[model samples]
Target: MLTKRLFSSSSASPNLFKIGSILKQTRTFTDADVLGYSELTHDANPLHFDAECAKDAGFNDRLVPGMLVASLFPRIIAAHFPGAIYVSQTLHFKLPVYIGEEIIAEVQATSIRRMKNKYIAKLSTKCIKCNGPLVIDGEATAMLPSLVIEPPNLASASS
Candidate 1:
């Protein structure tokens, strides 16, 4: 099952997200995605490009690069948080993801910390194959933009 959610920057605020808040997005990696990623990153591993080599490596088809699959977490976070900056991430590849398989990327706010002018969010991130198994498990830290409220304009009020 594929699901998409749109979040607008105008509606995004660090204060709006709380502990246990969750976001999920789904995607099916295709040949074009792999090709583009490979071209952009120069990741020309045979397992990702050669089906026979993939079969020899015990996978059914060309394997999608683990980093490419893990990238969904940042994409989801950036979309939802707008000005959020990624601080760190940890990943564990438990299973192989093949091309054309639908995968769900999920991020949950595990903790939220306020640092004066910034909000730091610790998130639990994971990717699962549709009706299959967990392919990647990870954690990430992001710094969300602080909410800035403009002081009421005294000149306008006086005017």
Candidate 2:
């Protein structure tokens, strides 16, 4: 069975990588975002930047790049799990996200296991808009930083 849950940023404790831990955030994909990403990635697809082309393609407005929509997952991880290293990610684009729509990106810890000295977090991720359509579905694996603490050096402190 598959479980689906939506979580808020404050719902999870930072640095505590526990199973079922969820983190989420929302961002509006604006024209500026699309333009900036296009300039950065050199992606000049008309569906993303040209409104007329998007309309011709049967979309209401210019479409946001799938990668741009996927980028929010990392921010959710960074905000709720500082020091976590993103090891891998997979995304499935479900629907096109139009420019100027606010979408929510959510990441939930589906499994947590200790590998060697660090914990590896397997997360279920997705992006949904205000109207309840999922724009992207994905999973990500993050290696949580070590929690080991070093012993205090009393000899050095005294010297």
Candidate 3:
């Protein structure tokens, strides 16, 4: 389990999330996306870059990298849970995600625990092809920053 501090601040309250709280995002991976990801990450897998190779491997089209698909989870988490630390994640790649296929990434909070000044949440994560099949299944743990609100100064108000 790898832990990463995703952000630092007190912009969001840990109370924003609760058991069964859910978030969903939809995306369609394109040729440009595949090329750019390959260029940046040097993943250059034949299944991702070569259609013939992918076909030979039993897929209809060039496959998207599993990491690329899994990356959506972090994006969803960070956007909805600002200032939350992405403590750890576990992923299982279940099926090939082809280029140009629309997929939906979803995260649901399953549990929340308070530890002193922060809240730790356990989340269920998954991605599914649009009207098709499940592509990824996973879990994530995050540390949400606690918001601090100071009481108004009574002496100043009295003056």
Candidate 4:
């Protein structure tokens, strides 16, 4: 639960890949995104929608839905290492996320179950500028592809 260090990606790589560490994807929050998420999820909590209410609530502005922001982790992990099998994910919403705020999600390979052929990635998603702790802290399991290969196209098979 620390903000510093933690970089190992896999046990397989002596150069960079090792168990118990990972990297991150950075993103900025926008007002439209907050509003849209509120609209879609019906999470009209004043802290997330009403500017005045949010001001009163002690937030600089309306906050973002934790769930909507959290949904990006999978995409980030996938983007970092394409074709890796994602097996598990668990998120704990820590603090509120504000619109116009940028966040960086850090993912680490905590351990691996060799017999099961699966890897565990412990993740910390947060906004560095705000001085607040991670907005979301979680763990994910993914099966990293040992080699790249194309899967048969299901469209052609069905035809």
- Index of the highest-lDDT prediction: 1
Tens digit of per-residue lDDT, candidate 3, span 1-159: 344322332454543455666677788988898898999998888898888999999989898898888988877776665577999999999999888889998888777777766778788999999896889999999887742221222110000
Worst 10 residues of 4 by lDDT: 150-159
- Residue-pair clashes per prediction, in order, are 0, 0, 0, 7
Residue pairs in steric clash, candidate 2?
A: none
Candidate 4 lDDT over residue span 32-114, tens digit each? 88778878877778787688998997778887777777766666556554677777678887777777777766665565443
Top candidate when judged by TM-score against the true structure: 1
**Model 1 lDDT tens row, 73-120:** 888777666677999999999999999999988888777777656777
**TM-score, one value per model:** 0.81, 0.78, 0.80, 0.64
Sequence-dependent TM-score of model 2: 0.78
Q: How well does candidate 4 match the true structure in TM-score terms? A: 0.64
Pairs clashing within candidate 3: none
lDDT per model vs. reference: 0.78, 0.74, 0.75, 0.59
Which window of ten consecutive residues has the lowest lDDT sum in model 2?
A: 150-159
Q: What lDDT does candidate 2 reach at residue 66?
A: 95
44, model 1: CA deviation in Å?
0.5
lDDT of 2 by residue, 30-111 (tens): 8889999999999999998788999999889889999989988876666554577999999999988988888988887787
